[model samples]
Target: MSKQQPVLFSIGWNACINCGACVAICPQEAGFVSPFDTIAVDRPCDIACLLCESICPVDTITHVPVEQPAVSVVTVDR
Candidate 1:
């Protein structure tokens, strides 16, 4: 069975200088730069393209694995 990996992106608000590099480079327009100078990821990403991650000048655009729900195993007590 093949498992597809899903990624969750985060922008380091403190480190982000509002350069708009990521926002401009993302073809999907997934990266947004608010008028208040905040950066955010507005939607789920397929991660097929990493343009935003590659174009972040401050290296603030990053992704971490989304945690999978825990599976419970049933065991019989003898």
Candidate 2:
């Protein structure tokens, strides 16, 4: 399964009222900020459960597909 990453839209950034709902619901602890600042902290994530997205009251959180590493194949000729 593909892992998801949460993104806070610019519109949501401006609309955010410093509510801790998203930060509290995040299972990965990917988002964090001070009470006065709404800016979220970025971190490496393995699971994107979308808990934060579901908890956002203003619908500011969205999930984007994380790019997976490409696999290389080598063919041998006899």
Candidate 2 segments whose C-alpha is farther than 4 A from its true place? 1-11, 29-41, 69-78
1-78 per-residue lDDT for model 1 (tens digits): 114343557788888887777657655444344553434454444432566777777787777664441224333338
lDDT top scorer: 1
lDDT by residue for model 2 (36-56), tens: 443343432335566666777
**lDDT of the candidates, in the order given:** 0.57, 0.50
- Model number with the top TM-score: 1
* Clash statistics: count for each candidate: 0, 0
Ten residues in sequence with the least summed lDDT for candidate 1: 68-77
